[model samples]
Target: MHALDYFNARLEATISPMDYVKAKQMSPEKYFLIDVRNGPTHVRSVTIKDANVIPEQELQSRLNEIPQDKEIIVYCWDVWCNTAAKVAKFLLEHGYKVKELTGGIAAWKEMNFPVTNSDQGNNIPDNCGC
Candidate 1:
């Protein structure tokens, strides 16, 4: 495929921070936001509020927890992080509709979007003690 075609195709698998907000506003239930940061990073950094906490390393084991009906939107710490992309790709390969959050949580924070600090790691699901 041409470079432009490749770029366009790649864009389809990603969502911008602003567009994410709009999508959530339009239909909150249509998307399933997952924070793929590891336990340590997630505890120290702020994450998009209400995002399901599933560290990248734990994804395979937690795959069943992800809802198949909603479009998965995965995000990591920042633009430098590739955890989200890896997780998105895994989900796609496993037959799930997924998208990586462009620039990750850093871009979302740069956009001044709503976020919740996870000082105590409470964002993680009850079943996960980490």
Candidate 2:
């Protein structure tokens, strides 16, 4: 497929960070958040509350761990990164509901949403603990 075609296709599968925040606030149970950044980066960076760390390279192997019932929202570093799109596409092809976070973590942070950084000793929010 042409580059534009690929870009357009991925755009259709993405959710804006603001929209995601609304969804998360209105119905947190409807979607699962996935962080597709590599381990070291993930550890150093803050992530959306309750997001699961599933780096892109390990996603396929960890497929069984993700629930099929909820929509999955994947994010990487920022808008310039396409890792989330790749993972979203893979999940969609595998029959799982998925969407990419339009601007990734950078956008999320820009919106002033809550995030937890393990390196900073911040309390990581747990879905079950909420």
Candidate 3:
């Protein structure tokens, strides 16, 4: 099977960028946004507003930091990146409700969603320079 097929077969929880936006707008409290990128990449790139940074390498050990009640939505750099899927799989196997964000942060920006960076302003540029 191809990588996409494998991912599709193995994962059931996923949220589209538009759907995520709607959820955030309709009820921001319903889910928790998690960025699974490493620290360096996270620092260089823009992230969704209010997203929690839990690098994929540390996610297993840091599972305790995530709340059990809320749905967890994970994202990485982009659709090609598998980190988000891996994190979502780990969370699902661990009995936490989870969803991988389709296309990751890049897709979010492509859809004109809001993002922030420490060095940059509140709204991330459309190009992102990622």
Which of the numbered candidates is closest to the native, going by highest TM-score?
A: 1
TM-score of each: 0.85, 0.77, 0.77
For candidate 2, give the lDDT: 0.78
The parts of candidate 3 lying over 4 Å away from their true place are 1-12, 119-130
Give per-residue CA lDDT, model 1, range 20-76, as digits (tens): 889999998999999887645444467799888777767888899999999999998
Tens-digit per-residue lDDT, 31-70, candidate 2: 9999877535434367787788777777788899889999
lDDT of 3 by residue, 1-130 (tens): 8999978864567889898888888997889999877545435467788888777776778889999999999998887778788888888899989998988888888988888774422232233222
Deviating ranges (above 4 Å) for candidate 1: 39-45, 119-130
Regarding TM-score, does 2 or 3 come out ahead? 2
Rank candidates by TM-score, best first: 1, 2, 3
Each candidate structure's count of clashing pairs: 0, 0, 0
Displacement of the residue 71 alpha carbon in candidate 3, Å: 0.5
